[model samples]
Each structure stands twice: as structure tokens, then as C-alpha cells.
Target chain A: MMDFALKTFGLTKSFSGKIVLDNVNLNVRKGDIYGFIGKNGAGKTTLIKIVAGLLKPTAGSLELFSSSDLNKQRTRIGTIIENPSLYPNFTAKENLRVQCKLLGVSDEKVIDKLLDIVGLSDTGRKKAKKFSLGMKQRLSIAMALVGDPEFLILDEPINGLDPTGIKDVRDLIAKLNSEYNKTILISCHLLGELAKIASCYGVINEGKLVKEITASELEEACKECLCIKVDNIEKACDILENKINITNYESINEDTINIYGDFPNSASINSELLSAGVGVNSIIKKDKDVEAYFIDLMEGKTND
Target chain B: MINLLKADLYKLFKNKSFYICLVLSILFSYMGTMINFAYNSFSNAQSMYSLLQMPELNGIYMFKTSFRGGMLFYSIFIAIFIASEFSWQTIKNIVSRGFSREKIYISKLISCSLVSIIITFSYVLVAVLYATIKSGFGKLPSHFVLNLIRMILLECLVVISITSLFVMVVFLIKGIAGSVATNLLINFFSGDLIVLGITLLLEKMFKKDVDVNKYWMFSYNNIFASFSLSNDVVFRGIVVCVLSLVVFTAIGIISFKKRDI
Candidate 1:
């Protein structure tokens, strides 16, 4: 069995009488960058907070490092939930030192190293209050790394960053997972950005875990579909359905049809259409990206 | 628990509000002494009843007066220190780092008590130094110093009790302005006065002379006054202080643990 770094079963949360998360089951294996994708008010932060031990679930159970005692296991994890929890009056270095003290890490050298890792080595006594949003986000990430935790949970870690800041954090997250062997569970609404680094994804919508799929499985599930344009689309569909024995296809418009599944012989289909007096105008393969796949999952077009 | 304590202490030392509180408390204590000295000098000059004729410069009187004068600033200090955690969202950070809610609450309690004690003693030190310089320490007998120590220790308990109450407020209100406002209102205005008012009303309604000291546990003046009274009253005061500390701390811890933040 692959050792799971974090797992939640039937994890639910509610504020007052409103349900925010409903029976969400999530899993993050060791050494995987698990992307938690959800929209606003989708309970992404709620779930992250519950896993981070900052908030307790109104119902359900969670396991960290395969241990049912999440409180004890929380020491092995680090988190940055919602906003960066920082003392504005303290400098970035001081904030990291405070985190170090909280985690009981005695090494003075790790502070500088983490600052350098987060590209904040030159903050130089400037208080966090004066730092920009990007700088604050980077410092929060650096703080999360204070304990050298095995698991890192970042909720919208790059929410308001510029393009460069986004890329920098993306690269840093990838490096932390691949190079440092850290298992990361990151939540973000930006599917494209998350797609770049996430090894697996958990889609949450309306306070429910809609789907969980590995990146490769999602890639396969979103495989390219062959699109064909013809003068007589109905006759082309008849030929594709009866002659070619292809039932996994949809008529897009009056002159276009999309064929799913493995039909490597596109020329044969065109030839078959032509022989049936259907003029083949164009043939193309459209690849579905992560964004389209995510939309499909959110809209309940695909089975979980 | 040790790590939590260290982190809390580190934050306490780094907090500018704590320093501001220290400075303000010291200045307030010195200002009280200087006002008294000026009054004594003016009274002595006028050949009226000299203010120095009153036994107010001894260690016991100075400790009591300075501590009482510093209580307002002490409440503010607790409010700022605890409420800033909410304002800054650092409490969430601490909670996320694997510390139990009880541990975090206890750590804050210990750290706040430590800062309160430091502030209290700093005030006491300044008051004593001023009194000695003005009156030459000749009137401060050995027993007076001993009683001063006893009162200071009892005053520390009262400070801790007040700190616990503030902690409960911060956890309940969970905001800087709300916690500070509520803490000041209770500590400065309504905490003891309401209790005393109710006690007097009951005494009048019952048509019997009731020993109001028993119900004056929240009243610092009464508690401190009891120190000079019978040992039984002092024991009762100490019990009340300890009970307040325990009750407030329990409420704070339980409420904080159950809170969503």
C-alpha cells in the first residue's frame, strides 16, 4: 500500500446552520503534490483548515501520516490557510524565528536558508507590514517551511501574485515536492496553475468532493477527440455509426461531428463518408485541456 | 507545552505594546509619587496639615498605591497582547502548528501573568525607590517590608486573576477593539462596583448588617484592605482570587477550544 500522507473520510463542516463542507473524502499520498481545486465558498479553505488542525470538522474523521491522532500528526505538517498569519510589526526574519520557536527548531541557520529559498533573503529588517502582497505570501510560505515538515498544506498560496510571482511560487512548490521530497496539498481556484505542478487533483464543488483523479488519469480522460466537417453531417454520422461501427461520437453542428475513442484511421472515415456522397470538408483533432476537463467535472458531465 | 510557552514569551518580548505598557505603567507610578511629593511640599510650605504626616511613604503603602494605580494599564496591556493575536491572525498560526487549544491558552495565561508580574514589580520598584529617596527608608520597618512582600504576592494573584478574566474576554470577543473595550469596562468600571451595589442593596433589604467583605472579592480595595485585617478575611480573599483565576481560565480554555478560529 502506498503510504498516504493525508486522508479525510466523510469530512464535513458547518458554520451556524449552514453547511460548508459535506462528506468530503480526500486523499494525498506521500511525495505527491495534491491540488485541491474548488470555487469560492466551496469549502476549500474550510477543508484545509480542518486538515491543518486549525478548525475542527463538525463531523467526520481525518488521518494524517496514516495516524488517527491528527493532533499528534499535525506536528509533521505545515500550513498557510486563507491569509498569511503573520505579525505585521515583526520583520520577515523575526516571523520565521517565531515560527521556529513554535516548532521547537533550534537551528539558527535554517532561518536564512528558508528566507533564501523563498527569495526573501534581502528583506533586511523591513517589517512584514511594509512588505507587498507577493512578499507577504512568500514570507508565509517560508514560515510554513520552518519545521521542515513532511507535509505542506497551502491554501491559495499564490492567490494575488503577479504573473512572475505566480511562476516563482509554482516553481518553488514543484521544487519543494520533487527536490525536497515534501508532500504538498495545495488548494487553488486556478486550475491552469495547479495543473502545472499537481500530481493528483481533488475537485470540490458546493461543499462536496466531486472528483479525485491523478494527473495522468485526467490527461487520459481528456484525450483528444477527432472532429470532422462534412457537407452532409447526418449521412457522415450514419456512415460513422453503421459502416465504421463507431457509436462514441456526437454531432456538433450541421456540418461537424466529433468522434471520441481510438479511431486512428481518420482517412478511412473520410473515405467512407465520401463514398456515401458526404463531402469531407475538414478533419481535425481537438485536445481537451485541464480547464475544460475541470469545467466538465464541475458541471457533472463526467462520472466520479 | 514548553515550545508554546517559549513562542508566547518570544512574541511577548517582541511586542511593542508590551514595552509601551511598561513605560506607561512606570510613568504612571512615578507620576503618582511626584504628585504626592508635590502636595507634601506645598502643604509643608503652607504650614497646613503636612501631607507627609500621613504614613503613605512606607513600602506597604507605596506598593499598594502603585499597584492600584497600575491596574488600568495592566488591563490595557493584557487586552492589547491577547487581542493582537486575533487582529494579526497569529492565533490561527499557533493553532495550526500542532499545539492544542488548551496548551495555547495556558501558554498565553502564563506569559500574560509573567508580563503582569514584571510590570507590577517594576511599578513597585519605582515606588519603593521614590519613597526611600524621599523619606530615607527609616520609617519602613522589617515587618513593613515583610508585609509589603506578602501584599505584593497577594497582588500578583489578583493580577493573575484579572489576566484570566481578560483572556476570557479576548477569546469571547475575538477582536482588538471589542476585547479592549470590554476589558477596560469590567476592570475599571463595573466589575466591583456592581457587586458592591448589589451587596449594599441586599443589606438594606434584609435589614441586617452583612459583612460586605465576603462579597467584595472582585474589589481590589477590599481584597487589599483585608490583608491588614484578620487572617480569616485574608484567607477568604486568597481563596476568592484563586477561584476566580481557575474559573476564568477554565472558561477561556474551554471557549477557545470550542471556538471556530
Candidate 2:
């Protein structure tokens, strides 16, 4: 069996008696890009912080590889929790050099190769404070990989990046997972980009993880929704309920309803509505994105 | 442990405030020795009678005068280093990198103490060398080595403890402004009041003989006093140094561990 990269049992944390994470249990398997999705203030950052050993959990047990052998294992784990943690006064090369020195990695060529990977090899002599937000972010990721970490935990890595920068990071994450075979746990608010890259997912809401699934299973579960525009939604619902036997539908308004499930029979439904004297305006098939799936999960309406 | 020490030293070297304090120390100590020699040489000018009541220009007096300004400056410098790490949020990064908090705390304490110790020792060496050149070393006292070593070690322990106190303050507030303001206030008004006031209150309450100078880290009279040769004084200085180190180090460690850094 592949090693379990990270595991937390009954993890809970509170500050000033206010709960930040309430009984959170997390499992991250090796060689998987597990996208951790949550809204703002949903304890995503807190969970990452605890795992990184930056904050002690109030009521939980965390055990990594034994410290005696941790140099071999822990040296392979990298992280960037919340904001990019780097000295703004130092150059990108200097920052990475310091990280490498901390890890006892003395290879200059390795540092250069890592910088080349992040496309920051030309940032020579330029302080991090002078770099743009995108450059600084890329440099931070490069720093995380200083020791050739086998597992990388990145929290909101693309929080403030532009579309291109987001794409760059998304591609980098994919490359890291696929090419490098690194077990990655990334928390991001941008579900759309996360959906494109993540192989597995954990949906957290209100400080509780409601669901975890593989990408293929999520793809199958989030079936297409048919957006139907009709003059009378109630009549359409009646027709769908009676003749079509379709209980999977939502009424958008008095004049429109979303028909989902069994998409091949859409033409039949249109003709059926026409024959039933129901004025059908349009029917559009819409695939639920990560956000819609998360909403469904939160509302307890997710497809099993 | 060596890596930890190297990291601490790296940080200390990078900080500009430490360099500025170091330069001030060297310059002031040199000036202090030169000025005394010049005064003695010009005593025949009939202008030095008004300053006759002043204490003798000894090695301890010259060294203290030269280094006192830098000592005060060193306090602020150490405070700034401790505060800036938290203020800039770089400490979170370091803590997250899996360095034990206790190790990090000890590293800082070691760095601060080393700086203080080195500064004091260098000042004394300069004062002695300059005095020997200007006014022929008059048979160096037998206890000179013992007392000077003890004095420097005492200053190191006291300054390190002071810096560690401010480290806790910085950790508590998690900001430079809050830590610096609170420390300045406490050091200037509250700390002295607590020391002198408590000592005086106890003396009056119990009709005991209390040496006010003995109760505080600093003493104005002691700074300018003549250095007499005595093994007892050196022994007492060693005890004071050990006590301060123990007390301050314990508090510093406990406070750091309990902090939310």
C-alpha cells in the first residue's frame, strides 16, 4: 500500500474559546493532488497551519515519521500555508539558498534547476520586495520544493494571481503531481481552476468536511442539468413528473425549470411538451462545475 | 545545534542596528581613554582644579563611560530585532519550517548574550591598551583579570535577560509598535519603580539595611567607581551573573513556549 502522506484524527482548535476547527479528521493519500475547497473563514487555513506544525492543535494527535528518521521523510515534505512566507528584503536566489541550507542540501545545481522550474532564474540580484505579486508567488513555490519534497501542502496558492498566473500555477501543480509524483494538498477558493487540476477533492463547509471523492466519481455524480425555458413551469413539472417520470428537476422561476438526468431523451421531452400544448422556449444542457457540486453538497442535495 | 547557532549568528550579522551599536561602542571607548589621558596631561594648565573631586580615572571607569552609550543603544537594537521578526511575520515562516520553538528561543538568547559579552570584553581591552600607552600601566592589579572577566560576564547576563524579556513582550503583542512602546514604558518607569520602591518599602517596613544599588541591574555610582582588587567582589559578581542568567533564561523559555507564535 502507498504511504498515507498526512492523517489527522479528531483535530480541533479554538482561540479565546471560539472554535476554529471542530473535530476535523483529514486523510491525504500519497501521490494525489487533493484539492481542499472551502469558502472564506471555513477553517481551511487553520487546518493547513496545524498540519505544517506552525500551530498546535488543542485536541488532536499528530504523528509524522519519527524524528530520528524524519530527516529522510520530513525532508521530503514542503508547505506554503496562507500567505507566501519569505523575506522581502532578500533576493529569490538568496531565499531559496537559505531554504536549501536549512534542509542541509548543498547542491548548487539543484537550486539552479529548481529556480529554472519556477521560471525565476533571471530574478538575479532583485529583492523579492521588488518582484511583482505573480513573481513572488512563483518564487515561494520554488522555495517549497527546496529539498525535493515528496509531499507539498499549498493553501490558496492562487488567491491573488491573474488568469495567466493562475493557469501557470495550475499547470505547475499538475506537473508536480504527474511528473514528480508528489502528494499535494492544496486549498483554494477558486474551485474552477482546482477542478481542472485536482485528482481528488475534499469539500469543507462551516469547518466540517462534508464530502470526499475521486475526480472520476465527482465527474459521474455531477450529471448534466437541462435548463428548460417554458411559458408554464408548473405544467412542465407536471408533464415531467407524470409522463417522463423525472423527479430530478428544479423550478428556476414561474416560467423556467431545470431538467436533469437521462440527457439523451431531451428531444423526446421537447416533443412531449409540444404535444401536451406546453409552449417550450429553449432547453440547454449545463454541466455542474465544482462550485455547483459544492453548493449541492452544502445544501444536502448532492447526488449520491 | 551548530546549524542553529550559525543561523542565529547569520541573523545578528544581517541586522544593521547591531553594526551601528558596535561602531559606537568602539568609538566611544577609544575616546573615553584618550580624553582622560589628555586631561591628566593638561592638569598643569590650572584649569583642572574644578574637576578634582571627581573619581579616579581607572580602567573600569574608562571602559564603562566608553561603552555605556552603546549599552543603552544595544537594548533598543535587541528589542527591534525581536520585534521586527514578529512584525514582519517572518517568524511564522521559521516556526513552520519545523525548527523547535525552544531551539529558536535559545538561539536568540545565545546571540544576544554573545553580542553583549563581546562588546564589553572588547571595550575593556581597548581601555586597558590605551591606558597603558598613554599613562604607563602602573603594575596591573592581581585581581584585574578575575574582576574584568566577572564584570563582562555580568553585563552579558543582564543584557541577555533584558533582551529575552522584550522577546516575550514582542511575542505577546505580535507587533513592533506595541512591543517597543510597552517595553520602553516598562523599562523607563515601571521597572525602576518596582525595583527601588519595593527595596525601599521592605527596608522601611523591617528596619533593614537595604543597598538600593544591589537590587537593580544598573547602578550609576558603581559605573564610575574605582576598581579595587578583591577576590570577594569577583565572586559576588559571578553569583549575580549566575542568578540573573538562571532567572531570566527560565522566564524567557517559559514565556516563549507558552506564546502563540
Candidate 3:
């Protein structure tokens, strides 16, 4: 708990008597890029808004850095919830300067530093309303970096970015976490991109946080299996069970055998199968990526 | 609170709409002063034979004219400036920071009042310029500078109260169109109805002659607009305006704290 940047205990919220975040318990550790995943209207924004102090929770509580004073603790955090809440008429530099004032930071160098970090340093005198969606998102990130907050909350940070923009933001998030040692709670629809940058993930479905697991745990759950198709199913099964002594393997179908662990390689397996009377038709390895894994998780299914 | 106020000031100065509104208000004040001068000149011509009953086109009288129909412009300015915070969703950024909701509301109130009062004072200056050019700043009530200072100090309370009312309305409505429409309705319909209601209530209860309008802020403002001054009315106006400012601000802060952005 001491190392955790944010932790919520049964945190709940509702609108018009309809629950939007139901008994959600989440933990985001320090220096971690935590990815919050949910479909559209699955309470992702509601939870983020609640944590960002934009919405009030109906029940339960959340702790930022295990402090009794939430507001004081909140000063150590920053957010860009829902859409980027930016002054449309101010330039990017001017916007950061305003945020600097809000955070009570006296250093003017911080403004230029933030703009440079977000790659908006050259966009001088251009109103934020004239900026593209990607530029606005970058500027929002820069605004959130004001006061040099330790924890950053970015809700749907890459909601509408092009691929290159997405990669840029992804690289930036990674850099912020690795180089600056900042804790980030980013919610995004791009699970594939998130898998590349996030250290862990929280999957929410229908307002309930269904799963919270680390990348290693997700990788372990979606581990690959060598599936071999053979002509003589009975002989292949007997060889896999008795000769190779591979107990973790299973016969997936009449002609296909799945080897879960302790197999030398596809080449050895193929040679062994050919040495036997079973004719090896094909050998393929299959595993689920983050999107497939998340979909299955959302649908209450496992990778297996 | 200081940081939030500073940020708000930064945003206000950088905003184009604020400057546009400021210029428009000053231009309108000058135009209105010219029209008042023409009408007052016509009345003077009609009363040229009656020298003793002539109207004073002095700077004090012109300064009082600024309070009349000035609320509409103040309401517009308040709506445009404050409502944009919600409409543009920029308030959420501030709220998400460590500032308390009360601080945010108070910061907005202070900044909005500061800017609106400046606009109001600008109108007064413009009107005074017209009056100085027309008449040599006529003396009134036997004490010129002291009475003028008294009038101004008394009126500042009411001006802040009016600004507070619009701030509360914009905050409660939480949108540009709704708050603007509600403010306009209040300016058009509220104070007179309250005065009439209280008048009828007192008359029915005690069969007494009473003037409830004198104690009412807006009604007293109308009375003050004629440069009509008395010690009792000034005291009553100050109390009512201060109390009204407190009530309006309290209601706004309470609602803002409980509301979801």
C-alpha cells in the first residue's frame, strides 16, 4: 500500500440512481503504466472522472498515497479526464502557463519544458482550438505534467489518434514511466498498443472491475501451445503420453494434439512423429495477443 | 485560492471574447451617454424660462445613470466569461487540481466581480467625461466631493451584490444559454415582483402604508439612480446589498460543491 500510487476500496458511483462504477477495487503502483480497459460505456470514464475529482462516488473510498488529506495528496497527481479540458483560445504555451499558475509553480522554465516534452514547443501563438486532435492530446499531456506531479491519470489518451500519433504517445508514456519514473494510469481502447507500454492492466465490464493482472500474469495465461495434426490419432496420442512422457499435452481433436510444455521443438516433434507410424500433417503454435486475451477476459472466457 | 484567481485572470486576459465584450461595453456606455446628453439638452430647452427648476446635467447625475440598464451588460459579461469555464469544460481542469470546490467558486466570483466592476467604473468614467464637457460638474447637496465619495462607496456594495447575483445564477444554471436566459429574466422580472408582493402583503396584514422597495437592493438601486440620497436609505441599501451578496455566494458555493462537473 505504501508503494501504491492509487488504491480504491469498493469505490462506487452512480448517475440518476444508475450505478456506473460498481464496487471497483483497483491498485496502481508507483512507476507503473497501468492500462484501464473497458468497452464504450463500460464505466471507464466514470471511474476516471471519480478519481480525477470530476465526479463524486456514491459509495466507498479511494486513497491517493495512503494520505488522510485527499486534496493535499491530489496535488501530487494530475489528470486529463474525458476530453482534454483546455482553454480553446489560448496557445499551447499559454495553456501550460495557466496550468502552472493553478499548480502554483513559480518557475517559467517548467512551461517551456512541458511544451518541449509534448512536442508543442514550436506551436507559438496558435490557439488551441486550431490544433488537431493529436496536438490537443499532446498538449493535454503537457498540461497534466505541470507541477511535476508524481502520478498522472490519462483517460482514453489515445482515443482518436492516427497510428503514428498513437506510437508517439505510446513512446512518450513509456519514456515518462521509465525515464522520469512517473506513475501513469492510462485508459485506452487500443489494447494492442497498451500491451506494448503498460506494466499491468485492469479490465472493466458493465461497471465492474472484472480482472486486474500484470503483464507477466497475462503472458502466462495466454502462453503458446504447439498443436500438431497427425493421420493416426491413437498412435500420436500414445507416443505423446508414453514415449515423450509429456504429461501436460492434450489431444485437442481427433487428429490434432496440443503440446503444452516440455517439448523439445517442432522439428524434433515432427521427426519423432514421422518415426512413428503417424503421418504429421501440420505443426503450428498458437497464442492470444492482448486484444484476444482481453476479449476473452471480457466474455468470461480463458485463453485455453 | 490565489493560484486559482491568478490562473483565471491569465485566462481572462488571454481570451478574445473578454476584450471584445469590454470594448463593446465601453462603446455602448459612450453612446448611451451621448443619447442622455441630447435628451437632457432638450429638457433644458423646454425649461429655459423656469431657471429655478432646471435639471442638473452634472457628473454626479451622469455617474448615477450608469446604474440604470447597466445590469444587462453586466449579466452578459458574467455569462460570457463564467459560463465559458463550464462550456469549454475548463473548470474541470481546475477542479481536478487540489483546489476545493469552494475555492474554485470563490476564485471565479472574485475575478468576475473584479472585471465586471472595472467595466462598470469605466462606464461611470465615460459618463463623467460627457457630463464634464456639458456642465462644469455641478455641485449637489452642498458637499460636492464628500457626497460624491459617499455615493460611490454606498453604490459599490450594490454593484458587487448585482455581480454576485449574476455569478450565482450562472453557477446554478451551469451553462451559457440557461444562465444567460435566467439572468435576463431576473433582471426583467424579479425585484419589481418582490417589491409588489411585499407591498401587498404588508398592506393586507396591517392595513398600513409601507415602502418595501426602499429596502430592496434593485429597487434602492433604481432610487439611487436619480441621485436621490438620504442617510437612512444609504444605510439600508448597504446592509441589504451585503447580506444579498453573502446569501448569493453561499448558495452558489453550496450547489457547486455538491454538483458533478
Residue pairs with colliding backbones in model 1 are: none
Per-residue error at A240 for model 3, in Å? 8.1
Error of 1 at B249 (Å): 0.5
lDDT string, candidate 3, A9-56, tens digits: 999998889988899999998888999998888898898888878788
Better of 2 and 3 by TM-score: 3
Tens digits of lDDT, candidate 3, B1-261: 889999989877776766776777778878887887788788878887987444677786777667644566777778888998899888878888778998888888888877777777777887788788877566665665676677676666677888899999899888898988888887776557777988999999999988888667777566655445877777778788899999999999998988888
The 10-residue segment of model 3 chain B with minimum total lDDT is B219-228
> What residue pairs are clashing in model 2?
none
Model 3: residues with Cα > 4 Å off, grouped in runs: A226-286, A302-304, B46-54, B140-143, B190-207, B222-231
- Measured against the true two-chain complex, the DockQ scores of the candidates, in the order shown, are 0.77, 0.31, 0.73
TM-score of 2: 0.80
For every candidate, the chain B TM-score is 0.86, 0.72, 0.86
Docking class of 1: medium
Give the clashing pairs for model 3: none
lDDT of 2: 0.72
Q: Model 2, which residues run further than 4 Å from truth?
A: A63-75, A225-263, A266-286, A298-304, B27-52, B56-60, B64-69, B122-139, B143-159, B182-199, B219-232
